[model samples]
Target: MTWTAPEPTRVGEPLTGPERPMLQGWLDWHRRTLLTKCAGLTADQLKLAAVEPSNLTLLGLVRHMTDVERVWFRWRAAGDHTVGSPYNSADNPDGDFDDVATADAEADLARFEAACADADRAAATLDLDHEFATARGRRSLRWVYLHMIEEYARHNGHADLLRERIDGVTGA
Candidate 1:
């Protein structure tokens, strides 16, 4: 049987909550929005570019976000600089977004999910005010949460357009 991206059960962001839960809720919502955009798409369709001269694809977005989750939450926020992107390297920095033509969409999606779960674990014991050093200087877990939500929200917008281009499906 042909593999297709599975639909994610997106939860509504909490209307009211503490700072951490509110941020986490929105981040999770955006993450699910990305997966929702890819639902029911076959590998080939997931690999389809948004348009010529642009390499964006649903599968590529999955891979890219997997790296983003790992980098910001697991690596930076959690202070595991040893963790590196699975789909990127100095020689091919854009691998996550550029290598989707033959990528396993199913596995990529699974990896994305795993990365998110790992990120959550990394942040679980930390305080929202927890701070870490980076080349850009110190950053707080709160900053990471805000940045991640913004990142996912921007990418999810691209995902919306890509999905629509692929199958004329639109909206959250």
Candidate 2:
């Protein structure tokens, strides 16, 4: 079946489940929370390239997270965590950082939403205890979940500063 990408998320709290997750679910929650920080800005705002050749921006982070989602669950996981994608070639793949020029605010938000949806599905469907081979070799699905959460959280911090610099907003 063809998977049309998810639309950009609404600007608000994440749509949560009735009972909260133990660990994996919590990781998923944090990832969504991080993305919410960039929720309402325009593509030009989201793609605001840093001064003096720095490649950092909210749009770059969105693409990188999509790469991370694909890397961890789609490409790296084993057993219950079956990974997949909506796109075939990531093209230069390095475009995650270098291609910010192509970022349409709506498009970037759509990419982030799609990644979040796939990640939510994987976290729900996977066996947390399942082992996956990584560059670190034999990492459990739980580790991947937590690592991605941490990764997203760290990027969100960077995003917080970037967003503030783009406008005048502040606070986490």
Best model per lDDT: 1
Give candidate 2 regions above 4 Å deviation.
1-20, 51-53, 78-91
- Residue 6 lDDT (model 2): 35
Compared with the true structure, what per-residue lDDT tens digits does model 2 show for residues 69-99?
Answer: 8667766763334454333345664677677
Location of the lowest summed lDDT over 10 successive residues in candidate 1: 50-59
Residue pair clashes in candidate 2: 43-105, 74-83
lDDT of 2: 0.65
lDDT value, residue 55 of candidate 1: 80
TM-score of each: 0.97, 0.74
Backbone clashes in candidate 2 total 2
User: Per-residue lDDT tens digits of candidate 1, residues 1-172?
Assistant: 8888888898998899788889999999999999999999899999999756788888888999999999999888888888889899999999999998878888899999999999999999799999999898999999999999999889988999898888999999
